[model samples]
Target: RKQLLAREMGLEPPATVELQESDKEIDPLQVSVLSVSSFIAQMRTVVGDGEATESARAQAARQLVRLAEAGVPGADPEQWWATQTVAEERPLNNKPRLSPSRIEALLKCPLNAMLKDTADNNSDKYHLVRGNLAHAYMEALGRGADEELARRETVEAFEKIQTSPTWKRAQERDEFEQLLVRTNQWIQETRGVLELVDVEVRVDVESEPGVRITGYMDRLERAVGEGGEEGGLRVIDLKTGSSKPSDEETSAHPQLMAYQLVLAHGELQQEGGLTKVVSSSQGEERDGATLVYPGTDTKKIGTADQARKGDEELAEFAALLPPLLDELAGPRVTARISPECDRCPLKPICPVQAEGKVTTDVNA
Candidate 1:
């Protein structure tokens, strides 16, 4: 009976199938910025079988262009001249060395880095130019830039940009007055906080050959006293935007981590520099900025008052910066998916998504 059963089982032996990974390596090619579809297809091919995978990948590639076009809907031929005029240019290193936003942009997408770094300097849109003038005006008030000139320049710049020439509103005069009032309020508040007065000022400073980092510090206080080293300097950065994040999202924000890393290096190497990012966004209506230090079980709020005290707290915070920076530079044993990916320019080429995996007719 046992022999009969064994023979019966052997009669329907499971089929043995062999799978081999092709040793043939794909050649590395520079992906074209224009050919995002091709980039998606190439990514799928890297991790798939040659046949069915190719067809799936091609379909995926076509979907990307369709999605992108749908998002913008359409382009105008009249604006073609402006678009071509601002064609991508060479990378600029003038990134605010202390701001996490700038660092995060570089890390999240180097292509964005390439785009920003090489941006066409000539495309001076009215709003961008106006905002820049306003920011500079504010910074000048902070830096004590020629007082009369700063005030006059700011007022002149604001008037031209307060509202579009094509726009007419019944409340335009009232709104414009309110803006001037607010600007004056900010200037008055700034005057009180700037005590170092005239000390060769700098922002986004760097020490050569040691480490490469950039940020936009609000001020670099250079006065020496009981709290100051002969070469000691204080770095403070301004935040015009909100600082809150959901509990989970706050933990991995690269901007704050990168800022801490740059400052920490200076602290560790005795470069006499200590940095603090001050959240200056303060108004009943405005959501103030907050600094979420890496690995810290606590969060720091940056009200206008907190920003005022930033210079005083530099020494105390320096002790905490080094360890925090180490956490940032540490090996990543886990991969995290950032939700910010949805709007990321490279979403089409993301390796994890396997987005464009349709088989293609190379002959077609």
Candidate 2:
């Protein structure tokens, strides 16, 4: 403090005081200033994937165009936008590769699926943090990190991610000890029977031309069948949510089925077509999927979903893709009112709920 005061007063500093230069690395706490390109990128996101009116996220198309016209370098609005007739026109991606959960959503209620952001939203920070930490912890474990190290890393990551709003919402989260405990429980649930082959497996399989199923399995494991026989590839999907879907629901789970489909047909995009590493470890047979919930079952492990040998179900799921693709290629989307609609954020403004019909015009 005395040294700083002397320096400020233009007085000679103490001999012991030494100045230090900082390295190129910016502190994580430092808020990043947006460059022109970054501004253009964010503006592109707002105009592209942002909600119909937002959280009221009306697309920022005009702003994007303005940026481009105003000579902002690399500001290509067209690249971000779906092919549209003109500015401010909302057009769907003619061929978007979808996740399995999205396929389920499309099956349940097209309107709700189309309207709701299936991925994380602004207010869902708590779930996002919890899920991320849990996955990271498990992933570390899969990569052979000991219990203590994984726990410490997860807790530290959670603390670093906490902001005022996140802290408030995450009050129920017990300093991530509970999440780590859940992670341990999930690891135990594996029972040493399922050999961990890989973590974070990415797959992009074409159900049909221009219609593809894209998803990431949490982990891939080799299971042992009855009587000590070596089993085929089993996909493990980790869930951090409290709500446990029933066995029947698991059997028909579009997401689980989709992962199975990936096992059967999808290429492991990261590995350049599931090279000898994946192919050698995981034999041809699709041993199906298991939903590992590492959050709710703290006292005792829950009866998690295990959907096996989904060939018939996979066929049915694939069969529906063609018709769904047909719908996507067209302008209008029909909403099949189901339980899923109950959770749609657009329910209040949805035309189906208001006028008993499917229409993008929320006010109508």
Candidate 3:
């Protein structure tokens, strides 16, 4: 139908090109500076190194005291930098989402939302560090490289958080280390079982006419082939945390799903021309994994059943685009005590909470 429409419109679709550039480049300097600075500032407060820079910093310092009293060296400094660098790359603007975390944050607290969206700074408490560690490790593993080395690197990064000099207070450092070791070990075990292929792809897409979304996927693999033409794409979303979310949660989660949708669009450019979804989890230990969907790529139509049933969850997510954009651009009715706020670590700093309660809670 798309081809026919193109013909009717006298347009010839351009040939597809495989992407060559890698994921966002990380400057070693930038990574080191940001991580080291953040870590130092955090440590200084924890040790009462200086007067609290701010209320949040003071809160963190107090929290660190508790961690120390509980016996937690602090995370390895090196690990902290590595993970923090990764965070800077896949930030909100560049990240695609059917249901953005930022949107969820905004729905919960507008002020908290502004801090992240407009200010471009997020409270460290909710930073998805564990998820990122798992993701980084998974990406390395998928490339069929040194798994042990990847594991070690990830562990080291994690340890950086466990053993900072700034954490001079009393706590059970051994206990925290033990937990981290167990967590990483389990992640290593899970990575050991998964199959990965060096499926490199270049995706050239237009988010809308004249606005293109072009990028390359370093690795791709087939988790399941629904037989012949209907097989699906299951792109992995390596996570450091437990993967326990349901299919609904996976489908509803935006980032991972957006990645899947991106992959699907790339697949559609080929002959078999199918919509692919890249699905992955944080890891086995934290829970399991959270799924996310961006959108489909194929212009081809499928059987009504396939369209309605197999892909219904994804379709529904995509349908949310309009409202999401509106909310982002317009004045949002303020609300409070959102159930979503529970998972958010920034709730304390959130101004909406300072105001009052409002809105529908999807989780509720």
Better of 1 and 3 by lDDT: 3
> Number of the top candidate by lDDT?
2
lDDT of 3 by residue, 1-364 (tens): 3243234334564455554576346656434233534545445434443552354445555555555565555533333322232323222343332332344454445445555444334434323564455456555655565766876777667655543365651242443333334433433443433333343344454323222334444334433233423233444333223334555544455544443434433333342433222222221111112222111122221101111122344455445444444444434433355566665555544545542211122121
Candidate 3 local distance difference test against the native = 0.41
Locate the minimum summed-lDDT window of 10 residues in model 1.
Answer: 280-289
**lDDT digits (tens) for residues 274-337 of candidate 1:** 3332222220111112231111222322222212123223334334333323323432111224
Q: Go through the candidates in order and give the clash count of each.
A: 28, 3, 48
- Kindly provide the TM-score of model 2 when superposed on the true structure, using C-alpha atoms: 0.64
Question: Under the 3 Å rule for N, CA and C atoms, how many clashes does model 2 have?
Answer: 3
Q: Which regions of candidate 3 deviate over 4 angstroms?
A: 1-130, 163-219, 224-230, 251-260, 268-313, 329-337, 342-364
- Model 2 alpha-carbon miss at residue 196, Å: 0.6
lDDT of all predictions:
0.39, 0.64, 0.41
Candidate 1 Cα lDDT to native: 0.39
All candidates in order of lDDT, best leading:
2, 3, 1
Per-residue accuracy of model 2 over 23-106 as CA lDDT, tens digit each: 445576433345876656555555556354442123355666666788777576444323423333344665667776577777
TM-score of each: 0.39, 0.64, 0.42
